[model samples]
Target chain A: MSTATLNVTTVKADFPLLGREVNGHPIVYLDSGATSQKPRQVLDALDRYYEEINANIHRGAYLIAEKATTAVEDSRAALAGFVGASAAEEIVFTKNATESINLVAHSWGRTNLSEGDVILLTTLEHHANIVPWQQLAAERGVVIRWIPLDDDGRLDLTDLDQLLDGVRLVAVSAASNVLGTLPPVRRIADAAHAVGALCLVDASQWVPHYPTNVADWDCDFMVFTGHKMCGPTGIGLLWGRRHLLDAMPPFMGGGSMIQNVTFEGFTPADVPTRFEAGTQPIAEIVGLRAAVDYLNAIGMEAIRQHELDLTAYAMRTLTERFGDDLAIHGPHDLENRGGTLSLAYRGIHPHDLSQVLDQHGICVRAGHHCAKPLMKVLGVNATARASLYLYNDESDVDALADGLAAAGDFFAF
Target chain B: MAGLEDLYREVILDHYRSPRNRGELETPPAIMAEGFNPLCGDEIQVYLLVEDGVIAEIRIGGQGCSISQSSASMMSAAVLGRTPDGAREVLRSFKEMMSIHEHGLDGEPISTDDQPGASGLGDLEALRGVVKFPVRIKCATLGWNTLDQVLDQTGT
Candidate 1:
């Protein structure tokens, strides 16, 4: 309901990399699904942390150490508030979203899951969400079932009762990185709860685009990364329900994640601290806080509105231009999707299409996009994906269309 | 655009359009090797029929981008009459041609045991332009790599 619209020009200018040229033309990056380009504000925040507050956190009596610890805690709290978590202590920092899921699969999966227990996943999950569970299933004799997709790429939950029967955990992605289908997470969570199952939301795609509320979704666990949302790399956030997180064992053992150590045995720390081992990524965490502040100032609802509107415009433009020749995969309903568009044009090989686009300085990811299973489901080897973020506008989409037209001419029989 | 043209020459395009020897032979009579480029999920399979120490027949399979598919076509045509050792020699020369820098053997541009037509690799020379676009170098070499693997399996 927020009427605050983003000024595309101003937002575009804030990203330093968007101004640079590639191959004698202005760069038009549409690969935010892979990783978003950081804005100047987020970039400056990293520099400021290194210059002013560079110190190892959590174990220092010195002034800079205290400051760094405070910064790290503040980032945790900010991220918690951003996602509507009850307490900052529930958020554990890890290397990336993949590591976050692995942390849960290794720690929580080992303790909670037994042989013959079922972990239900979706066909739309990225390999990060899928592989960890597979590893868990391999180690423990857990049977995995998939919630299949409909013809239009949305999750078909007609048999939810049967699918959730005796399921211990339901791990699903909030959005499909390839198809851009926003799965009905809240409904799925409710169904999962009805079956006495734990629900873990892989929000690596959804958190960056939409307004996220863990309590509203009623998910037991959620995980996402920083780099996709304008923060620096080497940092990811994992939020778990307080009781579950407290009960779960530590994932990695090292210098700092312990309360006490003995020759015989060792005692680990509590909650988030128990999970964060070794020297933490203080600067990147600080950068993440700055990124949250930036998004908060703009407001996530407004950002969502901008992207949704842009996605609609793009669909219309591309369809109008190419008609039957171009195919944009995913749901026809714009209300239930994000700004990611996986394009297939006139049967051009994705690699060829990607190469042609690069010459025009239009960067689109041309591969299986770490979702090889999804690729098989789509019945294509690969796709050229043009994903939009807060900074992208109609001009970027126009440039993509023009580039595709040029590719058509180049590959003409 | 000029760089793209160099990467996708007319011969490369023709080979992609109507690929030569695009199939497989029986298992006992032929050896098959498959290659996959993890970067783009494109795959290729090369089947070789060795008779009298020479490749009596060659066929290509799978699908990929222009560079990968066309390179396979050109490779199938090139190694038709050559011995397994001769095919390996051609692979070395083809890889050398596709390398961005002259990856000489111990500070030398050419290896000590060199073939006569290493520089002039016939139809395979169209792939030399792939060096300009470094990423597509993998695509161009997918066929040669598969053939090399199949030959290694054959042990001939």
Candidate 2:
């Protein structure tokens, strides 16, 4: 399933945004890590769902309502299958990855965590994974510990046993959005289970780029977003073990999540419906199903290989062209990294550099990347980040290099 | 290349490399205000030494992008010797020059050199190109906004 057999140009053509121009030049979109451009397949799914099957799911007995309900439930099943979940009932749809984590924090954290309990997390987590726990910890008087990062920006796992002691939950990102360093999720999950702690993996960055198997990773809970994987926004997924989800209380109280409601109290529904409180994003779930189908058609292994090749080529080209003037954060090797290149060029502010690059129609993210804690740890305010996807190729990387060289020339003293 | 030159003029880079009033004022009766752009992690602190309703001394301290730091430096140079009202006028003029509104000066069919209130802009006119880059406008005006906060705090 290597990308050598995959025609990269045809893949690029699938995304309509890739064909557009900006600022009188062809657009080189390298910000897929922030949000991926949707392919026509996913877009068509949304359009068809609205035009043909627009109805409120789960309540109405009309034909269109039944069709809409089938579409939404079928999407859950397909998404569960894509992530290798044991059953579709274990998949819970939410607004986005942020709400997915917050659901766990509010429901599971409020129930399980108490005073003197500790929740361990890694430094590479986005604010989404960090702030929820911090809020829960503040309310419950619980302690929070961190897994430090080594100089190369990979998680320092040498003291995993010590950090896991007295820990009730361990949350970590499978891949750092800032550094592109893929932490060993399987090892971390095994260690957390050995310590009798439930492990949660933030797969927002990992599931979009790599071959993800919740069963293989053996994590207790996992979450990822649809928009980052060529689907529409306003839809995400949370997959947990059936037993854990059943035991946890409902995160939000509403109509769809309850089985029986009295004037006094309510009895919650089963595992997934217990979490989906209100009406879900029906069209987005359908679009997400189409996105999953598109990825499966291309194959995750091929996508990973293509991104690795592009990453290797970008690292070499940028290093050769800029020399010491360009410094890329994270691991130098592509073995444990993805196609995200966070670069610092000769004291040029990332905002300034990104503005210069934008003039050439090269889009790159220049900010803390929602990982301000990681920014403080790395001793930088921000890095100009150029992230690649399956649609990107070596020419896009070359265009990035040329834009950076122009930045140098423009800002040269 | 022409647009790039317009945005990062030699005067802006010169101020970035060797900033004017690039320190804190130890004198008393000075008001300090800090501005931060959480998006890009740009932070700038402005200190003003106001006496008799005039900014007798001004100093800026922070770390940020070239546009921000250079704008702060040029802002210090522009308003150092002006009274409180005069400094506010300078701030308003700079904002006008950097404004990207539909009916404001940025939208007018006029050259950057002949822009209204060009005489009041002095070296601050180097930032006129920021109007073309909408996202970077915050970087160019972070210092001016902070100084406005400082002035408001002084109640003058």
Candidate 3:
């Protein structure tokens, strides 16, 4: 908050994992797209939670149990604020983003959707968003339509009106994990609403890198994971509109989600509680609160600005260094994309490139990035992705370029 | 710490550069089967031409990283003239070569008797370096697994 830009050195110091070495070399972690390294603040929060206030939340009545309940609610409120949601009860914590999406498909889709109804999705969706809808379609005989991608890898929304016709729900990713293309989420939400359809944005990649305001986007539902945002794993967020969640049934039924059980019929709790069953991820929620605090301390605007500069540097460096030998997928417009770079080295396989980079202690993900449909659009089975976060700086990008050069030489025929 | 030279042996790179018996064969006479490493989107297809008890001919199809493609090329070359039982022998030996070092990775002692070269699998022996990188073990075995599936499907 004090500074306009994030000091990469100070931010890097906050994360303990970056201080560690791999294979006798300093680690250049560029795989933030998969999962981010935890900051000491978040780790300390976890330690504090387990040591001081480990108990079942939402049901316990004693001192430590009450403290645990308060901690979980406080984290929910923090997450609601982080995503620009007015009500804390709108946030339902799931295992991760995949589970969050599934909760929506099962609770909302199962209750509201029927046979022949259409769910419009884009090629940019991760398997989490795509498969849930496909599962719903299989069960209900619902039809699924696709929003194609253009040559620039952004959504081709030329036939938006036609695609929205008869569509009950529209699900799409805010920023593509593979291509880093930031679709027009607000415009899509507006169009879907015009046709009396609901919109859900899978912001798993977008929320960490950008300033998010759910109210501004006006989407019915949104989802993101914790570990990807420097929080602990095993916790995720699903923020829904009050009206939508009010009508939907509970996703999972158990002790915490029930109001009363009479051994005959049971009454389910309200909204978020109705979805979160069993003992909640108390320690993970505490860690998530700390992660949100850390991000707030640095400020999201500063983080986005940092990544914008770093991404430009990375694109220029890779092009100058590898020339036509390497092709980086996604939009060239700086404002339309995030810092994630999905690379295809002309002759070298992504798996081999990843292996070679690993030897040099450069961490990158080599896979379809859980967006197999996007990979098909890019004409690649898999890609080596190097994504940037607030902790990343220009030197990490330089290290990646150098490591790639070494890989080229090592794999040379 | 598996060195690049270990995984990318000259022979493995050679096979990857110029794969032997590449592309698919006729599926009617040559039974075709596919294997997938879902983690990396690595898919390998094996087409087998069986005659009596012999694996008369073989072709490797599909695409993946070096460990997968080169292993397929090497497997095709090694098992071309051998009977199905003899090919399974090489498959078992290759599988063993890739699995032997996994125990060493977990700090368990690996016997000196099971050296990669001790198997004497010829060009296929070069893939032993794959075990040092545990995640890549699947890539190295993708070809062998697909071939084994096809050989068994035909009851050869």
Candidate 4:
């Protein structure tokens, strides 16, 4: 990408929601790991789409309907290209990453996994990824194993060889939402493949924060939510190998996913469509495509670098200011982590801290972050989390530090 | 930065840091109640020592946000020696106050002189400020919810 086109400040300004104020102060939205703010381009694309062409794709023959169909399929190819998937057929649309994981668990897992088969996951997985497998295992008598984490929250990869002995599928997060640790996905993928096991990468936290190529990672399936990547909420992508997607049974039965239905039986549509049942999230998919384009324009490399720098800045600011009173969970090294820090204030609870931060117009998450097993491993009920995205700069870090200090004083007094 | 004074009233902070009657009761037939805030994963466990329809003692243990912990502390301090009926009345008044931001407890002993003022839930009054901060409302009421469960279990 050309530096002439890369106007970082202008790009920041394009995000209209980021301009809003909270609690009589300019909102310092550091919770992008949860959901990112959309840019004008993405929002406008949705507006232009609805105004010009609004119709169900594939079946419609009218001009506007054809345009809508083209737009949807074009976005699909764009998204597939973005992930470096072998074909557009590999990309299936779902409501969010959770639905994507559930689709796989219900469809592929139900068919393949049986009694005595082992499914391996990590403690750092979101409830969405963990629960589906747990529910499946319970029904099929399959065993679930978790990869433990070290003190700094990096997954303990030392026991991978032993753990993979009977593992049928390895479902792991590319990055932890709570801890910010970016696991070695490629290595994990290689190990899983060696054992003839399918690998599913939950890249919900990693996709927006870093540049990812599914082909390079070589995972059997990859899932990420659009909302987390500065797109609309209802759309997410599940990229699977075409061969694997073709082999798996359909997840849900409804419109668009069927070729034809007869009294005798029904034949399912091809790969991608077979997994996506019902009316797709049309506007959201369009917005997601715009989001992907926006990021591509910015160059994900620059974004990743900027975030790494911000993470280092945040970690330094937090530790130096609070000392031992603050404990930052996750990998101590910034290189192995995403731009997230879940910290516990020694005396004050995360809820109190978040309340105080909210008053300051500093938005941060305070809780288990939907990773309760990780919380249990960390030995804390909850932690105050400040997650960063592209819009976050050094000033946000300063505000967070100031807020944490204020929380300490208020509670200590 | 907005000072914590806006949210953490001095009384509430005091209760949180040094909670009164924050522990467990003897294991024999204690009325146990648990409350959880699924949003934040905050949890509280409360045990009541009930004898002859009066709270002989009240003990609470568990981990949660400050509002819940302090509220639990204040709740324990308020209802320890009261009759189950009195405690239930106070609970009703407190719930009313939290939901509406004020209480007009009609014709109860709570309205009498020498009793605390409108927000004057006594130590429970420390949480009156919680109504303003909506998210903390769950934290403040977690203990009271547990207390409600305990009340239900004992059929009082």
What TM value does the first chain of each candidate achieve?
A: 0.99, 0.99, 0.99, 0.97
lDDT of 1 by residue, A255-349 (tens): 88899999998899998889999998889999999999988888899899999999999999999999999999989799778898999999899
lDDT of model 4 at position A1: 43
The alpha-carbon deviation from the true structure for residue B93 of candidate 1, after best TM-score superposition, in angstroms, is 1.0
Residue-wise C-alpha lDDT for candidate 1, range B1-156, written one tens digit per residue: 247887888999999889999988988788898998988988898999899888999999887999999999998888899988888888887887766333432344434225444576888777766766778888888988899899997786
- Runs of candidate 3 with Cα error greater than 4 angstroms are A1-3, B112-117
Candidate 3 residue-wise lDDT, A275-356, digit = tens: 9899888899999999999999899999999999999999999999999999989898998899999998867899999998
lDDT of 2 by residue, A335-378 (tens): 88988889999888999899889889999999999999899999
Clashing pairs in 1: none
* Total colliding residue pairs, candidate 2: 0
Clashing pairs in 4: none
Better of 3 and 4 by lDDT: 3
Backbone clash total for model 1 is 0
Better of 1 and 2 by DockQ: 1
Descending-DockQ candidate ranking: 3, 1, 2, 4
DockQ of each: 0.60, 0.58, 0.82, 0.51
- The interface root-mean-square deviations, each candidate in sequence, come to 1.9, 2.4, 1.0, 3.1
- Cα lDDT of model 4 by residue, A6-26, tens digit: 345676799998788988888
Segments of candidate 2 deviating more than 4 angstroms: A1-4, B27-31, B51-53, B96-114, B152-156
lDDT minimum window of 10 residues, candidate 1 chain A:
A1-10
Error of 3 at A135 (Å): 1.0
Best by TM-score: 3
lDDT of 4 at A197: 96
Candidate ranking under TM-score, highest first, comes to: 3, 1, 2, 4
